[model samples]
Target chain A: MNRPKEIFMMTFPLILLLGVLSCLYLESCSAKKEIQLIDSEPYPIEIPKGFPDIKIPEGNELTKARVALGKKLFFDPILSVDSSLSCGSCHLQKNAFTDLRTTSIGVEGRVGPRNTPSLVNVAFNPYFFFEGGSPSLEAQSLGPIETFHEMDFNAALLTKRLAADEHYQKMAQEAYGMEMKLFVIVSALASFERTLISANSPYDRAINGDSSAMTPAQWRGKELFFSDHTNCASCHPAPLFTNFSIENIGLEKEYQDKGRYRVTLKNEDIGKFKTPGLRNIGLTAPYMHDGSLESLDMVIEHFNVGGLGHKNQHPLIRPLDLSDHQKKDLIAFLHALTDQDVLLKPEWAP
Target chain B: MKTIKVILMALIGLTMLTLQGCDNSGCTDPDSLNFDPEATEDNGKCDFPNLTVNFSYSVDGQELTKGTTYTINGTAISFSDVQFYVFNPRVAKDGVMEATGETHFISFDNRSIEFEDLTAGHKHMLMFGLGVDSTTNATIQPSDSDLADGAALGPQNPSMHWGWDNGYIFLKMDGMVDTDGDNVPNAGMEFHIGKNINFNTIALEIHTDALEDEVEVTVDVDFAKAFTGIDLSKDYITHTGDFPALANTVINNMKTAFAKK
Candidate 1:
């Protein structure tokens, strides 16, 4: 019995020592093995040669943490004053970042005056807003945030709310190295938005010398678009599909909206409005600044009629006289602007 | 032994926390981040050219003297607030036409010179008459602060932009015109002229040679001559009501003013 006790005392310490060592080893191994919360593959952003480099603001550089936070904020109703709406409320990913409604509903269900434009490739735009009023993406993000009908939240309050949350505070600091400010919040969102480039489309492939990219109908449509019969390329030009210039396409004799003229206050500029890019236009419906047209066919019909019979209408907006096949073909060509890669980005979703 | 064990556990925990914190530091994932190789280089400053335009006018048979106060057909007129715009000026080297620069609103409330030398030649153009071309107008956004505030034009100067409607007032001629029955001091007449559409932009290409050596281009605008095409007495008893009607009537006659004289 004495011998048994001695053996127990000796073996117990040895076993205890082994157990402790194993536990420490396992803990060290666990510490070394990090849980990779983000995917290894980078988001694709192809900048063509000779194009001006896009300037992403420092402190809010594009990162997984920042993008992930922005994505959550975009989908979260917390950004809205009433917790009733989100950016994604109007800019649904499936609908090419545009709402299906003629006009978007804002906080408290107030309808907006203008239609929601697409977010795809918005980073490439040199100017923002319907009339090209906002000069940069950072400046543009502030519009809907404080608009009475949109988020309806003061930017200062937004910054405060973000800073108050421990989770957001940590993420913001990690991404921006400090607590969130209004500029940093918007910059983060803008940084996330800048990554929303759409390059891989059927039209892009065709332009890049891929013969099999476009269908025969789309090919015919492409020809018609560039042809003088349609003359669509005059305004909706190639590459970016927008010259970033405004025009008064004769919507009315005297526009109550005044389009761009509201900004310039020049007489000749009365009815002018910015010419939107045609890329992925098929996905963004209810066309025009007011979302007057419902479909691509209706838009074609409107253009065929040489726009509204207003005197201020653009002289370039002559009658197209496109046939049914031509219209269909034109629509097919527009569909070629859809970038599947942009639409299906898993990180873009909530 | 127990004290030593506690110290060792504390050290392990500290090391783990330190490693965890360090892992996230400088851990910019290349796949998630987009780095522009072009962005490495700095974009140079925006260089705008210098635009200069000079204006002179003749009254009756003689060249109007600089700083001479005179009345054109009984309108007390001074070239005090004269401004200029080039509808689109072409840069000789770029091969691309320069956009309409900011309006150089002249600030001369008191001083007078018949010949006005408008500086910033690369910025201003001598557009014919009062209105900008429709093509240029169509692209201009009213919301553009550069255009709306008249950054080129001096602030608070009365220009023909209709605050009610969305177009520009086509003609703006502000000077004292002798009227039959008007009580307002200065008896100023404003010819705010604009058209929604069907209005033609009279193209007047003032040659570079005309502007060379900063020579003054004479533009003789007779306030009474604006009414030569229309009898205002028959159109309206007074210039008190409905300026648009008056503007419409005056613009119809003003078309003759740009007949390649």
Candidate 2:
């Protein structure tokens, strides 16, 4: 009887000790998980071969948390004053991030003046927007938000709103290592945009010595594009396919929008617009600064007619007189620039 | 103890949330490259794309100040006040010209003008007008501006604008004319010159000092030449009434007034 009672007393204390140890371990695990959230690792960007050297801006290094936060901000309609439209509303990933509307509708369904250009490979561009008003991706980031016809939300209100959200706070703090700031918000968006690089296309492959990749029709179109007669390559060159220059293509005899002239305030620059990259031209249709043209055929026809003459019209943009067959071939060549990496990549897709 | 840790973490997060709010500060001028939108306080630190140029009035190589006596078109006059309006200044560089959209005021007190937010690093020719040009006066209404843009320079309080229909008085030269060349009391000649047709764009016959960030140059205004050929006997004032002779006299003489040095 004495031996059994002593055993029971000793076992009771051991049982209690086991229970306390398990509880402490569980608590420690939970606490460690919280700390891990704060020390989240930076994201990695694997630059494709033969692409332009990417320069990540100072103090805005890429991180998984930053990219994830940016993607969320991009898709969130809370940016708009009415919560009806997000940046992604017009910039759909499948259609090369264009709304296809003649002019994209903004907050309260207000129609914008210019066409939404595809943002693929925009990291290589030094200037942004159709008029090239904004200098960097960071500078261009704030324009749409305050533009009366676009997002139409005040910056102060946006900062306040983002700060109040618990999820945004964690992500922003994790990514930027600070609370919600305008710089962090815009920088995050631009960092994600920097990741939106499109280099994998049939045209890119052809340029990389895979001659059999492009069809014969595409080859003919390529020749015409580079030839002095067309001289399309002078502005839209190979690789990135943009000279990063603004020019007047003689869209109309008299311009209403005034294009780059408004930014530069030079009369000679009137009706001039930044030459958009031709990386994914086929996917991003309804072209030009105003989205006035409905199809690639119409755009080619405009160039073929040499564009109604204007004082500031580019010297090389005279009549092409390309045949219907040549025009079709040119379009096939344009279609050859479909970037599968930008389209089907899980990281880029919505 | 675990519950206490969770509670403490939550409190820390809440404190951080309270700490970070909108604290924006930057240039407020919309025309500047560094325009900040979220700035709540004016901060009075607005920066503009500006080039500095100083205007100095002189007659026959002799600089004149307010209450100074000088000879003009054979009439010796003592200028009590010499104030003028400088219309939008156009800067020409490398054969290309660009204009600042805003107007400016020039007076005895304010001889220095900063051409806000202009192109830098080129040999530039700065051209300005004596008064508001007819085209601008007719198209851009002064009352239409919100005043926050610093538009309509020196309006209302300084007596630049005469009336809504009459438009702004581009140049106001008030003084007493002495026919006998005596520095004594005489008839007052208020040359309030302004009209759409009377607008004169003065091309300063001087070049900037390879204008970079900011360059200071003297804009010489010849008071004598400002009335080269006007019949003082008929009318010495050109205010609201259509005194073409007086207007023409001032416009013709005002040609040689400005020179950048």
Candidate number of the best TM-score: 2
DockQ of each: 0.02, 0.02
Instruction: Mark the regions of model 1 whose C-alpha exceeds 4 Å error after superposition.
Output: A1-44, A48-52, A57-61, B1-261
In model 2, how large is the Cα lDDT of residue A102?
85
Error of 1 at A89 (Å): 0.9
Query: Candidate 2, which segments miss by more than 4 Å at Cα?
Result: A1-40, B1-261
TM-score to true structure, per model: 0.51, 0.54
- Model 2 chain B: weakest 10-residue lDDT segment is B141-150
Candidate 2 backbone overlaps, count: 6
Worst window of 10 by summed lDDT in candidate 1 chain A: A34-43
Model 1, span B102-131: residue lDDT tens: 332322332112222222233222343345
Question: Which residue pairs of candidate 2 clash?
Answer: A43-A63, A43-A64, B49-B116, B49-B117, B49-B118, B50-B117
Kindly list the per-residue Cα lDDT of model 2 for residues A159-203, writing each as its tens digit. 678989988988877887676766667778887888888778888
Tens digit of per-residue lDDT, candidate 2, span B84-117: 8887777787777777666777888777776655
